[model samples]
Target: MAKRILVVEDNDLNRKLFCDVLKSQGYVVEPVGDGRVALESARSFVPDLIIMDIQLPNISGLDLIEAAKLDPALRPIPVLAVTAYAGKGDEERIRQAGAEGYLAKPVSIGPFMAAVKGLLAQVGAVAG
Candidate 1:
C-alpha cells in the first residue's frame, strides 16, 4: 500500500501544495486545515506520517505533536514539523515537542520528500 501521510496546515495554499507534492510521489495524502481537526483526523486516518505546520488556528502544531506523542495509538506515527519559524531555537523546540524531523518553509519538494521518506524508513526499521 502507498504510505499514508497527514498534512496539518492552516494556510490553504501551503496545505494544497504539500498535499499535491506528496500525492505526486504516490503517497495517500490527507490534508487538514486546523490543529483541532488534525488531532481528530490523526486518530481516524491512522497515517504513517504527519507533516505539521507549527503555527495553526485553535491549537498549535507543537501542542498537537505533544498530544499525539502522549497517545499510545498515535505515538508511533512519525511527525515532521514543517514551519516558517526558522529561528535559532525553533528546531530544538520542535524536537522537544516530539517531532521526528523538522523542515523550514518555504520547503523544497526534494528535501521535504527526502525527510518524509527517511522518517518512514526509520519507523519501518523500528517496527520490523
Candidate 2:
C-alpha cells in the first residue's frame, strides 16, 4: 500500500502544492486547511506521516505536534514540520514538540520530498 500522508497547511497554495507533490510521488495525501480540525483529521485518516505548518490561524502546529505525541494512537506517526517563520530556536522548539522532521517555508520540492521520503522510510524500517 502507498504510504498515507496528512498535510496540515492553512495556505491554499502551499497545501495544494504539497498535496500535489506527494500524490505525484505515489503517496496517499489528505489536506487539511484548518488547524482546529487537524487532530481529528489525523485520528480519522491515520496517516503514516504528517506534514505540518507551525503558524496557523487558530492554533499553533507545535501544540498540535505535542498533542499528537501525547495521544497513543498518533504517537508512532512521524511529523514533518514546515514553517514560514524560521526564527532562531524555532527548529529546536518544533523538535522538542516531537516532530521527527522539520523544514522552513519557501520550501523547494527537492527538500520537501526528501524529508517526506526520509520520514516514511524511517517509519517503514521501524514497522517492518
Candidate 3:
C-alpha cells in the first residue's frame, strides 16, 4: 500500500503544492488547513508521516507536534516540520518538539520528496 501523508498547512497555495507533490510521488495525501483539524485528521487518517507548517491557524504546528509527541498513540508517527521561521535555533527547537526533520519554507519538490522518502524508509526499516 502507498504510504499515507498528512499535510497541515494554513496557506492554500502551500497546501495545494505539497498535496500535489506527495500525490505525484504515490503517497496518499490528506491536507488540512488548520491545526485543530490537523489533530483530528492525524488521529483518523493515521498518516505514516506528517508535513506540518508552523504558523497554522487554531494551533501552531509546533504546539501540535508537541501534543502529538505526548500522545502515546500519535508519538511514533514521524513529523517533518516546514516553517518560514528559519531563525537561529529553529531547527533545534523543531527537533526538540518531536519532529524527525525540518524543512524551511518554499521547499522545492525534490528536497521535499527526498525528506519524505527518507523518513518513510526509516519507518519501514523500524517496522520491518
Q: Which candidate is the best by lDDT?
A: 2
Model 3 segments beyond 4 Å from truth? none
The order of the candidates by lDDT, greatest first, is: 2, 1, 3
Best by TM-score: 2
Question: Where does candidate 1 clash, by residue pair?
Answer: none
Q: For candidate 1, report its TM-score.
A: 0.97
lDDT (Cα, tens digit) per residue for candidate 1, span 1-128 = 89899999999999999999899989999999978888789899989999999999778999999999999999999999999999999999999999999999999989998999999999889988
**Runs off by more than 4 Å, candidate 2:** none
Q: Is candidate 2 or candidate 3 better by TM-score?
A: 2
Worst 10 residues of 2 by lDDT: 84-93
Worst 10 residues of 3 by lDDT: 51-60
Clashes of each: 0, 0, 0
The candidate, 1 or 3, that scores higher on lDDT is: 1
What lDDT would candidate 2 get against the real structure? 0.96
TM-score of each: 0.97, 0.98, 0.97
Error of 1 at 98 (Å): 0.1
